[model samples]
Structure formats: structure tokens, C-alpha cells
Target: MSGDDGESTIQRIQDIVAVFVLSITAVLTAWCGFEASKWGGEMSIAFSQASSARIQSTAAEGEAQSARQLDLSVYTLWIGAKADEDDRLADYVEARFTPWFTPAYEAWVADGMVENSPFAREEYVPPGTEEAVELSETADEKFAAALENNQRGDDYSLLTVMFALVLFLTAMSQRDVKTWVGRALLGMAVVLDIVGIAILLTFPIKI
Candidate 1:
């Protein structure tokens, strides 16, 4: 073919490629939005399920604590003087007090003298253990949520990146300006990643 005819064929191919790239990018962006919405719903369900399971578990454990008791002698034995009174008191309280009351009383604090009642005394007990357990439970819930969301988010991210790559392959893909839009889309992807990270950080409460 003549030189002019060959140049015309190349230009036609470039135009076709540009159109294909634009179409692909638009489809990917729309798909990402759709997937993100779907992921939000899945995460909500996971949160609810996990929360319910944990509350049920806590109730069951509390019930188990309520069904046992120590005879007076056993109670005395458990509460008997020991070098480390705290251990003795914990055992004493666990043996005699009702499940609901025991943990609370065990955590109480009296005077500086440190009189811990096995059954019902005052002492300072840190709530961090309970909080940690609760936070761990919450974290599990959030992690499950993130798993669902991130999976979908990852798919969206992959498509977005793939579309960007397609744009790069086009001769008239608007190198400088469309590049800005691509960056914006990338920034949105980063936002999704940050959200997943936040869920992980807040899930295990700092106690």
C-alpha cells in the first residue's frame, strides 16, 4: 500500500483502540461501585451474626458459673490463709458466691489493708480481661466482615487496575488528563483499603 494509505490504516486502528479502552474503563468503574455496595450488605450481616453468637456464648458461660457451690468447710479451706491471699480469695469466691455476684465482688476493693473476701470482699480488679475478651469477639466479627468486603473490594480493585492498564494500551487514551481520572479511581480504591484496615484496628479495643 502507498505511504498515505498505510498512515490512514494506522490512525483507524488507533481510534478503534481508544474507543475500546474508554468503554472498558467505564464498565469497570461501574462494576466497582456495584460490588462495593454488595460488600457493605454482607459486612452488616456478618456483624449481626457474630454479635449474636458472642452474646449467647457469654450467657451460657455465666449459667455454668451459677450451678455450683462450696460447702462451708470447703469454702473455709479454699479461703484459708495463704502467702498469696489473692489466689486463695479467688478460689473462695468462685466456690461460694452466685455466678452473677462472685465476679463482681471478687473485683471489689476495700481499704489499703487489702482484705479480699472469697465470698464477698472489696478489692480492685481490672476489667481489661473482660474487655479484651469482648473486643476479641468484636474483632472476630469485624474480621469476618472485612473478609467479605475485602474480597469484593479486591475484585473491584483488580478490575479498576485492569481498566487502567487497558487505557495505557490505547494510543489516544488521553495520556495526561484521563490519567488524573485514573488516579482518582485509584484513590477511591485506597479508601476501601483504609476502611478495611480501620475495621481491624478498632475491632480489638485497646484496654
Candidate 2:
């Protein structure tokens, strides 16, 4: 071929390569944006759940504290009645305490307290205390999830920003630099874009 024709062929090849690189970069940018948005939404939901769980835990804790005070009052009244030999007062104390007793302790009492009473040894928990502890644990789990989702969202956003950089470099390669250096920059941008896309695919979308 003539020199002019050869140069034309090379120019056409470069144009084709540049177009391909730009197209792929555009797709990668869009994908990264979607992933970042998804992660951000998940983070928000997790934060809301964590806040609600924390509120529930706090309320349960308050109820548990109040119940503990009542338990203490009942125990003190029972002791006072027994010490004073007031049968009627002791009966009233027993009746008030019955609702707080666990089913096993109640059964033991029904069996005439022949064996060591679990209630007497204070082995059982109050009704709401266990639930309060569970709520607190749920709150902790939700908070942890929110933190993790927030970090992942940040990572995705950073990747999206990197993809934007890759697009800028690739576009610059066509106009600012037209030699081998420009082709090398385009190649590097293509590689970076591919790697970013792969990472974006690995992350799961929540909701």
C-alpha cells in the first residue's frame, strides 16, 4: 500500500480502539453508579432498623428496672410479714409474688417445696428481663450491619469516582495525545475500567 493509505488504515484502527474503550467506560460508569446507589439505600435501611431496635431496647430496659423494683418491694414485704408473725400480711405477700414466679418455681411450690426451691435460690429471671436482653442484642446487630453497609456504599462510590477518572483519561488520550503514549494511556484506562466493573459485580444489591 502507499504511505498515505497505510497512515489512513492506522488512523482508522486507532479510532475504532478509542470508540470501544469509551463505550466500555460508559457502561462501567453506569454500573458503578447503580451499585453505589444500592449500597447507599441498604445503609439507610440498616441505620433506621438500628435506631428502632435501640429504642425498643431502651424501653424494655426501663420496664425491667421497674419490675426489679417491684420484685424488691415484694421480697421486703414478705420478709417483714414473716418476721412479725402476721399470717394475713404473709398471705398477701405470697399472693402478690405468685405472678412474678416462673412456671417451674410455681410447680415446685405446688409440689410442697419438698426439694430445694428454685425461687428461694433466685435461679429464675423475671418475665421481661430476658426479652430486654434480647432486644439489646438485636440493637447491637442492627448497628453493626448499618456500619458495614455504610462502608460498602463508600467503597462503591469511590469506585464510581475512579471510573469517572478513567473516562477522563481515555477521552484525553484521543485529543490531547495522539502518539504511542496516548494509546498506552487508553490501554491503562481500559484495564482499570474492567477491574472496577468486576469489583462492582461482586457486590450484592440489597432490596
Candidate 3:
């Protein structure tokens, strides 16, 4: 072929390659976007369940604290030894608190908070085993806050990941695309992806 014809052929080939890349990117972007949408639905359900569990956990912990207080008061009244009333109160408190303790500890265990199954402290002893129960409201409050934060964080992390995936799909769609409107959209998509990446990197996972 002539020199000019060869150059024309090369230019045509380049244009074809650009169009192919754009088309492939558009298709991949659409696929990833669908996956992200599916993930978003699952994340929503998981969040709702975690929220319900949190509310229930709070209520149960409150009941356990109350039981512990009663056990303490009864122990003090008996003094230096076990009395029938003290034993009865202790048993009652144990009954009321066991369910709460078991579930709360189990949750911690499931989240890898505790190393031992059926975990308990070696020195752990409830009220009526010795003296009046010394209530540390701060400890319980901190624990509740931790649990809440952990759950909230997990939910948010999952959501943010899905969002990031969606943005990635958008970015793929925009890359190497052409058209005045397409260019504008591509710019917006790049900005969104950057913001999404920033969010994912800046925030710590709750757990």
C-alpha cells in the first residue's frame, strides 16, 4: 500500500481499539453495578437484625444490673454468713441474670471478643458470694456503647463497601468514553469514586 494509505489504515485501527475499550468498559460497569445493588439489599437486612439485637441486649443488661443490686442488698442484710433469705435472693437474682449474661457473653464470643466458650473471668463472682455488690455503672455503660458501636460500624462498613463497588462500576463506564454529555458524566463519576475511596480509607471498622 502507499504511505498515505498505510497511515490511514493505522488511524482506523486506533479508533477501533478505542471504541472496543469503551464498549467493554460500559458492559463491565453495568455488571458491577448490578452486583452492588444486590449487596446493598443484603446489607440493609443485616443492619435491621443487628439493630433489633442491640435494643434487646440493652434491656436485658438493665435487668441483670437490677438483679445484681438486689443480690448485693440481700447479702449485706444477712452479714458474715448465708441466711435463708440471702440464699433465696441470690438464687432469684441468678435466675433473672443468667439469660442476659449468657446471651451477652455469647454475642461477645461470636464477635471474637472472648477467647473461651462459656467465658467467665477466673476471679468472677457475683453478689451474695461475698459482700454487697459494688455497682460500676460506668463499666456497663462502656460495654453497651462498645457493642452498639461495633454493630453500627459493621453495618456502615458493609454499606460503604457496596457504595464503593457501585462507584467503581460508574468509573469503568466513564473511562475513555466520548460525547459531550458522556464527558460530563465521566467527570462526575471520577469525583464520586474519589470521595468513596476517601470514606473507605478514613473510617475505621467498628469491630
Candidate 4:
């Protein structure tokens, strides 16, 4: 072929490759944006759940504290009545013990005071203690999930940026420039596209 024909063929090939790269990069960029948005939503949901669990845990803990105080006060009153030799008042206080407190008090008495006081016994589980622990654990898991979702969103955002760079390079490659420079830019764009796609494939898809 003549020199002009040969240069024309090269130009045509470069245009084709540049157009293909631009199309693919545009799609990848759009997909990355979509995934990032989805991950962001997941992060929001997880964070909201974590917050709710934490609040519930706090409320349950409050209930437990209130129960503990009430039980302590009643037990103290009973002790005072006993010290004053008022069996009737002591019986009244014992009868008024909360159901949960009664179990611990019974266990304490059954064990022959091996554990000091009812409050000191392992059997003295306050109301809502188990619920508070479970809710706190759930909150921790949800918070961790939120962090992971945030990280996933960031990864997609990073990939979107990378695709944008590929688009820029592909567009630049289509510009009028020295033959080698255009080819170099195109080659770089293609390589970056491959890397971005590989990374994209490794990531978990939301939709």
C-alpha cells in the first residue's frame, strides 16, 4: 500500500479502538456508579439498624437498672425490719419482692447463704440483662456491617473514578497528536480498562 493508505488504515484502526474503549468505559463507569449507590444505601440501612439496636440496648439496660434499684431498696427494708425484730414488716417486704428478685432470694436462701447476699449470687440475673446483652451484640454486628458496606461503596466509587480516567484517556487518544502519542494513550486506556474490569469482577454485585 502507498504511505498515505497505510497511515489512513492506522487512523481508521485507532478510531475504531478509541470508540470501542469509550463505549465500554462509559458503561463500566455507569455500572460502577450504580453499584456505589446501592452500597451506599446498604450502608445507610445497616447504620440505621445499628442505631436502633443500640437505643434498644440502652432502654433495656435502663429497665434493668431500675429493677435492680427497686429490688435493693426492698431487700434493704426487709433487712431493717428484721434487725428491728419486726417479723410482720419483714414478711410484707419479702412478699412484695418482684418475681425476678424472688428467684434470686430463694436461691440465696436455698444455698444457705453460700454466696453472701441474693444480689451477689449468679442466680441474681436482673430483668432485661440478657436482652441488653443480645441487643448490644446485634448492634455491634450491624455497626460492623455498616462499615463493610461503606467500604464496598468506596471501592465502587474508586472504580468509577478509574473508569472516568479511562474515558478521558480514550478521548485523548482520539485527538490529533503524534502517531506514537495517540497509540500510547490508547494502549494505556485499554490496560486501565482491563484492570478496572478485573477489579470489578472480584467485587460483590448488589444488583
Candidate 5:
């Protein structure tokens, strides 16, 4: 081929590659931005759930504490009545024991009373104790999910930046420059695009 024809062929090929890069990079950048926004919404929802669960946990814990105090007061009264050898008063106090405290008190008495108090017994699970524990665990899970969502959002944002750079490089490759400079920019853009896509493939996708 003649020199002019060879140059024309190279220019055509470069234009084709640049067009391809621009098209694909633009799409990828939009996709990354969309994913980042979705993940940010997920993070916000997880954080809200965590906060709600934490509030429920605190409320349950307060209820449990209140129940424990009530049991303690009744038991203390029973102890005083028994020490005074007032069987009638002791019996009345024993009858007044809340349902939750009854099983633990019975178990302690059966075990010959405790250096480990009735409250220490496994049977001593007060009202709301289980709820408090479960709610606290839920709060922790939601908090962890929120953090993971935030990280994923950040990852997508970084990918968006990378794609923006790819677009920049691809556009610059078409500028009036030396042949080697154009090829170098195009090659770098292509490499970065491939790398960004590979990384995106490894990430978990959200709608």
C-alpha cells in the first residue's frame, strides 16, 4: 500500500477504537453511579434498622431491670419475715413472688439455698430478658450490614471515578498528537477499562 493509504488505515482504526471506548466507558460509568446510589440507599435502610433495634433492646433491658428489682424486693421481704420467724408473713411474701421469680426461688431452695443467689440461677430469666438479648443481637447484625453496604457504596464510587478516567484518556487519545502518544493513551485506557470491569464482576450486585 502507498504511505498515504497506510496512514488513512491507521487513523480509521484509531477512530473505531476510540468510539468503542467512549461508548462502553460511558455505559460503565453510568452503571457504577447507579450501583453506588443503590448501595447508599441500602446503607441508610440498614442504619435505620440498626437504630430501631437498638432502641427496642434498650427498652427491653429496662423492663428486665425493672422486673429484677421487683423480684429482689419481694425476696428481701420474705427473707426478713423468715428471720423474724413469722411464718404467716413469710408465706404471704412467698405467695406474692412474681411468676418469673418463682421457678428460680424453688430451684435454689431445692438446691439448699445459694451462695449463688436465686437471681444467679439459670432459671432466673426475668420477663423481657430474652427479648433484650435477641433485640441486641439484631441491632448488631443490622449495624454490620450498614457498614458492609457503606463499603460497597464506596467501592462503586471508586469504580465510577476509574471509568471517568477511562473516558478522559479515551477522549485525549483522539487529540492531535504523535502516533506513539495516541497509541499509549488508548492502550492505557483499554487496560484500565479491563481492570475496572474485572473488579466490578467480583462485586456483589444490587438492584
Candidate 6:
């Protein structure tokens, strides 16, 4: 072929290659953007959940504290009832204390006569304490889950930034350098973009 024809053929081939590279880079960029957006939304939701869980935990802790105070009051009442010499006063205090104890303990008190009885000294777990503890534990679990989701979101964001860089490099390859160096840079960018996309796919998508 003539020199001019050969030049035309080479130019056409370069145009085709540039178009292919640009197209793939555009698609990858869009995909990375979408994934990053999804991750950001999920991260926000996770953080919100964590905040709500903390609030619930705080409320439960307050309830637990109140129950402990009530238990202490009951103990003091029982002690006063035991020290009283008048039977009627002792009976009145015992009746007031009955509502504070659990049903099982109330039954024990009724059968054993708690004043000066062996069962009177037995530890009493106030109502609501167990439920409060369970709420606190649930809050901890939710917080941990939120942290994990946030980390995943960060990872996806980093990959999305990397994909943006790939798009920049590929676009520059078309205009800045006309030699083998340009092709080499484009090749490297394509490889990096593919790797980033693979990693993004491996992460579980929320919503």
C-alpha cells in the first residue's frame, strides 16, 4: 500500500481502539458511581439504626437503675419489719413489701413467713432488670453491625474514586500522548478499573 494509505489505515485502527476504551471506561465509571451511591445510602441507614439503638440502651439502663433503687427500698422495709416489736406493725410492713418482690418470692414469703425466715435474706432480682439487660445487649449488636456496614461503604467509595481516576487516565490517553506510552497507560487503567469493579461486586449490596 502507498504511504498515505498506510497512514490512513493506522489512524482508523487507533480511532477504533480509542472508542472502545472510552466506551468501556464510561460504563465502568457509571457502575462504580451507582455502587458508591448505594453504599452511601446504606451507611446512613446503619448509622441511624445505631443512634436509635443507643437511645434504647440508655433508656433501658435508666430503667435498670430504677429497679435497683426499688429493690433497695424493699430491703430496708423488710429490715424495719423484722426489728419492730409490735406484730401488727410488722404485718403492715410485710404487706407493703409483698408487691416489690417477684411472684416466686412472694409465694416463698407466704409459705415460709419471711420475717426472720431463711428465705428473707435470699437475693431478690427486681422486675424489668432482665429485659433492660437484653435491650442493652441488642443495642450492642446493632452498633457492631452498623460499624461493619460503614466500613463496607468506605471501601466502595474508595473504589469509586479509583474508577474516576481510571476514566481520567483513559481520556488523557486519547488526547495527550499519541505513541506507545499512551497505549500502555490505557492498558494499565483498564486493568485497574477491572480490578476495582471485581472488588465492588464482591461486596454485598444493601438495598
Best by TM-score: 5
Compute each candidate's TM-score over C-alphas: 0.44, 0.83, 0.40, 0.92, 0.98, 0.75
Per-prediction RMSD in angstroms? 12.3, 3.2, 13.6, 1.6, 0.9, 4.1
Residue-pair clashes per prediction, in order, are: 5, 0, 0, 0, 0, 0
* Model 2 regions lying over 4 Å from their true place: 2-4, 102-123, 176-178
Q: Each candidate's lDDT (Cα)? A: 0.52, 0.77, 0.49, 0.94, 0.94, 0.69
Worst 10 residues of 5 by lDDT: 113-122
> Which residue runs does candidate 5 get wrong by more than 4 Å?
none
TM-score winner between 1 and 5, please give it.
5
Report the C-alpha lDDT of model 3 over 1-207, residue by residue, as the tens digit: 999999778656644544554454455444444544544455555555555555555565566567556545543443323445477655554445444344544465466856442224333343223222222333345455555545544545454555545445455544565544444554455455556556555544322
Measured with C-alpha atoms, the lDDT of residue 110 in candidate 2 is 72
lDDT of 1 by residue, 70-95 (tens): 32344455546344477857565556
Model 4, 18-81: lDDT tens digits are: 9999998999999999999999999999999999999999999999999999999999999999
lDDT of 5 by residue, 1-207 (tens): 999999999989989999999999999999999999999999999999999999999999999999999999999999999899999999999999999999999999999995467998999998889999999999999999999999999999999999999999999999999988998999999999999999999988998
Model 1 Cα shift for residue 86 (angstroms): 34
lDDT agreement of model 4 with the native: 0.94
Q: Residues 1-207, candidate 2, lDDT per residue (tens digit)? A: 999999889878877887887888788678767767887788788889888877887888787678667777776787699899998998887777736554545666677867654344454566667778888888888889888888887887788798888888788778866578787888888788778878877876754
Give the range of the ten consecutive residues with the poorest summed lDDT in model 6.
Answer: 117-126
Q: Would you give me the overall lDDT of model 3?
A: 0.49
> Which residues of candidate 3, in runs, are more than 4 Å off?
80-207
Backbone clashes, candidate 1: 5
- Selected candidate, larger lDDT, 5 vs 6: 5
